[model samples]
Target: MTVADAAPMPAGPGEPGFAEAVHVFNSLAVPEPAAATTARTVEQVRSAIHHAARRGLAVRVHSTGHGAAAARPVRGALLIRTALDGAVEIDPRARVARVPAGTRWESVVRAAEPHGLTAAHGSSGTVGVVGYALAGGLSPYGRMVGLAANTVRAVDLVTADGRHRRVDAESDPELFWALRGGGGGFGVVTAIEFDLFPATTVITGAAYWPGALADRLLAAWLDWARDAPVIATTSVRVMNLPDFPDVPRELAGRTTFAVDGVVHADDPVSARRCADDLLGPLRAIGAPLLDSWQPDRPSAVLLAHMDPADPLPILGDHLLLDDLDAGGAARFLDVLGEGSGSPLVGAGLRQLGGAYATPSAPGGALDRLAAAYSYAGSGLAADPDAAAALRAHCATVRTALAPWDTGRVVPSFVEDFEQPQGHLDAERAAAVERVRAGVDPDGLFRQDASPTTTRQEKVP
Candidate 1:
């Protein structure tokens, strides 16, 4: 339902609701971020948060809320929007950026581009930078630079206890690690300072093929991508395109395979050579109807996947794999091929390992997420059951690949679950608890659905 349909709530400066909340976007019928919070400024944020805590209100912090859960707070909750509207500082000399909690990945990229630098941003620029890095951002540049969270220089946030704290590799090593991939279960981050790359652009884009070649194309892609260069960030997607005019005529109304490409920190000649060398096998497998894998501005890297710019309710399920060999390729086709059950709009296989699997610095928290290869589903219709079924299918795929499955899941793509934030398993759970106890003594930030201490039994 639209905000107009919901009952209006009294609000203050930062507390915009109904009318104001109408501008907030949720891919589903969920309330907008404006309706979720009643505060704007840092001081106002603190007051509203403390008031809610004293009154026993559940505090939820959101920016875009891309992976919002099935259940959400309605009363006595404070949603901070300050960071979303401000707090972006770029230091070219220091090669760092300090962004507010609400900053989107796209803005960070644009800001850094002028400085000949780039933040390791996700494919979907609409995602919040703080949220993404907090959950250990796995960006297109991830394979080359490692997870985004590992680049963090410092994090300024308020803990559950209503106290503000700055955490970094040096200040609070343990807490810093847990916050990296543990989600926001520890506290509400207001601002974050992280490293930036000296990259203005790259050779990036995508190539699409007809779905009938799903098996052939995937098999070829698997072989070619297995040993791809670290400079080339690639993904193979199985997409069920709608009959939208905006979609390429060849791909419209068809299930197509895309060999998405992104090349960074490489010369033009090396970049083109890398793309040709890596993708040549896929091209040889079948004639692509649409091939746009040419040089382009780095800022347009999102073109690799060509996802929609608007927000739409989405359900995603993911798992890490050890390999996607020829035999595994056949199985993947059978599960998500032309006419599979609960047909997904999009499916992606991202190669992992390389820089992704490298050991993190001495005390990095995100070093724990296991596995390099990750498979994810995107664009589920607004049907809950349909979404659930898609998730089930992904789980089945994971189980079938048990020997190759890493069991480690990225928080970014685990949104298909009833409670998306609860996917952090046993090992990640213990480390997260120590992070909370050490950094957020009062538990002011709402990182996950439930704090680490309360959900001890679920993991152990």
Candidate 2:
């Protein structure tokens, strides 16, 4: 039966339902659409699309709204906030998982761990699964398993015509390719099925030292990261944490350098050795103020990064960078480290190599990031003046590191819509466009495309 046959209408602006439907994780980028609705099933998603088509409204899709800041404005559109109803289905023997849209990584981790398996999930367990995986996710296990998008075996989405299609490498290779990391705009994804890797326990956590030791720590970390093992994925950050009850006393209101990541292997002994190889040199530089690195179940990996649980106004910038030499390292610390007087709460580089540099056998549009490290800096925007200051600092940092910038980005890491974001070359982008045009001929989902990947005018 078609949605046109029978379905509830969406809520217009100012309606109670509209308020609930437009909820987002980033307070700074709350969407104001012409109409909105929550879709808990495929039938509801089809109905929302049919409604938008009849009203001549463009369609936009989001789940947790964690990437709301990076998305194009939803003005004059009907936003479909997906909350697909279902439990994560795991196939232990096949080492695969089928996750419904609106589901979070925490649930998947819990489900997979029992079977001695885990998916390539990001640091924050609260991030929606569909958006992260589809946008070429950079996981705690990324260096070992490659981008999360490569693990996708199939996708189920409701396209513009209200047709329910399940595309995979065999059924429709082209669409499947574009859907993986072609910068979205395909349709409302209902569920995703991806391969899971065998993992039970892993050594993961964070270690911190005073900012005074940043120079030595930074140099030592870069040297180690250049030849770091594939079994370990780690990052170093300079943080200025707030004084909160949950925060450790030593870290609050102080500039500190931190190193955190995951180390996995077939046995506990090997995992410990991998952790020692990376942490030993830094420990020699100075005593740490706080250290939480330890062997634990895979679920502990999420807490190691320390992403906030509540929503906040965030402003930031991202870049995929080539190897940074001594000069580049000095430039980075000059703008964001110790005495830089930087407004950003956190700024650092994520180690990217190993599997990240290798292409997947049957990968999607964005299968791998060729860069050496991912740089990101962000600050809280508590008010208008603070927001402007954060923007200026982000630009300052961008300019300082321009020499090493690869002029590319991973869609998942992009924090703002206005940042220079591009993951695909011209040839690949054009190819993705062709598929988009075929699937959405009338541009119903055009606004949903990432500005960097499409020829569309930049959103002002």
Candidate 3:
């Protein structure tokens, strides 16, 4: 059986074909897994890893398709689908959660909401909790708390040697560091335990304005961002959304500018005051056609950016930048702003620094963002022609911003396996390699599993 026929697989292996025993969400035509297998429990995962080792087959893992990259090639690997179903175990007293590798943030949010606590989740609620946090999650709440990986307490994984190990600061300190943000190389993570914040209420939402005010709005944001409190994190996007029923009338089929973010405070009253400090100045520049910022449940943070829940064939490019002064901002708007002939569906700048830039105790391999901003752009290319155009436009924007590019990348934002995220510097990468040697001495995972973690995406 081929990749196309894996769906509605047989209830048991060998009943029809062993290939049908696994489940995957993405429908890409390439990178077919040699034999799709499902792991319902930790023992199953360990067994699968051992089988791959004995047969000289590499293991590639997938859950839902939120981490899908249009350009990755998984042609001849054994794909381990970890939809290992389980609910989050939230220890309210300890303010921590042990999330299954297959779990999505939406479920975790639901689990934490009632306790007046929030996980350090990325913008999209559908993102896999394990992969996101392990890759240095850039949460909407990151500025207040550090990167999500910094909060991880422990990880339960099946190492390349097929041994189940619970690694943490005390058990296996080095592997613990690598697992946090270093990318997946040493083992197959089955579950993770990380800290959650005490956020009873938060001020969060999006505010959109007509695209015509691009210049003034961009200028206003540049000035305001400098003083924006660490209590909040935000991003400004220039979008060209398709006209669809789900899209509001004001934004449908129109180019618009929107600033969406979250402000976290201990109490509801404090949250509003901090939010007003940022919004008041922004509103003075140009009134918004849509203002959805208001106090609500902590779960509302997941909706601030309104990321789609379904899988998408996203072709994306990312660059970390130094401070965006007037010069840097002008160069940015020139390419992605009004009338740039850009084919991208959208382009935006996510603010970094604050708690994100600060160093923490017992830090992991991937720490501090170091850059002032992260510039990302992507297009939904359903056809070959559109796909080529999207890549070209990304290169064009990257060239335009070359002067300010820091050449650093965050592991989580690395959407394409072909285009490695290069999350570490040369020295750090070498150190991670040394650690890899310790755990995977023969490089049992070098071909498939290692590349996912060890890709060294370049500076141009």
Among these predicted structures, which one has the highest lDDT? 2
In candidate 3 the C-alpha lDDT for residue 224 amounts to 72
The regions of model 2 sitting more than 4 angstroms off are: 1-7, 453-460
Q: On residues 66-181, what C-alpha lDDT tens digit does candidate 3 reach at each position?
A: 55562246556666777665789999889999988889998888898888889889998888898889878999988888899998999998878778899999999988887877
Total clashes, candidate 1?
A: 21
Which pairs of residues collide in candidate 3? 31-74
Best by TM-score: 2
lDDT scores in order: 0.68, 0.91, 0.76
Using TM-score, rank the candidates from best to worst: 2, 3, 1
Winner on TM-score (2 vs 3) = 2
**Tens digit per residue, CA lDDT, model 1, 155-263:** 8877766677898878877777777766565666778999998775587778888888888777776776777787887888888877887877888877888888688
Poorly placed runs, candidate 1 (over 4 Å): 1-26, 29-35, 70-77, 81-87, 359-363, 383-403, 419-428, 438-460
Query: After TM-score superposition, what is the CA distance of residue 269 in candidate 1 from its true location, in Å?
Result: 3.7
For 324-365, candidate 2 gives per-residue lDDT tens digits of 999999999999999998999999999999899895575999
